[model samples]
Target: MMKYHPLPAFLSACAVSACLFGGHAQAASWKAFSAEGGQAPAPLVLPDLAGRDVDLSAFKGEVVLVNFWATWCEPCREEMPSLQRLQQKLGGRGLRVLAVNVGEGVPRIKQFLERTPVSLTMLRDADSDVMKAWRVRMLPASFLVDRHGMLRYQIVGEADYDDPAQQAPVLELLK
Candidate 1:
């Protein structure tokens, strides 16, 4: 039988509860930065939970939010619900959230999803190559890509993505 790691699971559940129940201080607001003079990132090619290859280039002409995360990260788990809300709010306007899970198997991700459901697109980067290519050193790094496929903004940490202020830049990119 597989041993259950109760500590990590309990801690992650606590983190999510804190965020849901008045833990605003733990969540950081995203800072908008200019991507001028920087080359557009190479295409993000990774497998979905179904093992189908998903390419970021395929999302050209749409505003895409690429988020690098892992099931082990508490903050990442906390911010997931808000990302789902953001996707629901702007999906009709061509906004897509691609959540890239770093260095984890489908079974682990499946277990995490069972505990915390998110409707956004989920991709797996089991080797973490995509995370390295995007220079994501943190657990919940996020980037906004314009309709033209250019990198426009980035959030280095977790944020309340459903908040209007945090959604401003993404909405603007859609225009």
Candidate 2:
């Protein structure tokens, strides 16, 4: 058997490691979108619970956290309380958390929210227009919009909204 040189062995290991890690990094990169310094993303307009037009543009000067969720998603349900805690902790400081319920009727949402003890400003995306416009492929997707209406961070799964470390980004922009 031919002996492999230590240099070649190290190089081979490095190459394989790069390839494996690169794919995972690439996938994670796509999971979130960066704002590139407060640049407004593609515009969207959706209605709130009262059926009034709540245009995304209207929240220009506020740090907005838009969460695309559903009553059926367990993770979404799990994170709602955290989000509510986050909102209550920070809502007074120019933070707007819009919990957009995807393709659900008001009665169902109302019934659900009435029992659950989370206090997020809920919006009904019953027609799914907002969901489609935002290209929301997964449930419990979240986007942090800066005060200037730029799409900053996009988290594609359930997250701890109340965690001080996780909420650091939101807090930084709020200041």
The candidate maximizing lDDT is 1
**Tens digit of lDDT per residue, candidate 1, span 39-136?**
49766999999999999999989999998887767678888999999999999999999999887789998888988988788999877778778876
Instruction: State each model's CA lDDT, in order.
Output: 0.79, 0.71
For all candidates, the clash counts are: 0, 0
State the weakest 10-residue window (summed lDDT) of model 2: 22-31
lDDT of 2 by residue, 32-96 (tens): 35334744566667677778877777887899888887775556777788888888888899998
- CA error at residue 15 for candidate 1, angstroms: 14
| RMSD of model 2 against the true structure | 14.0
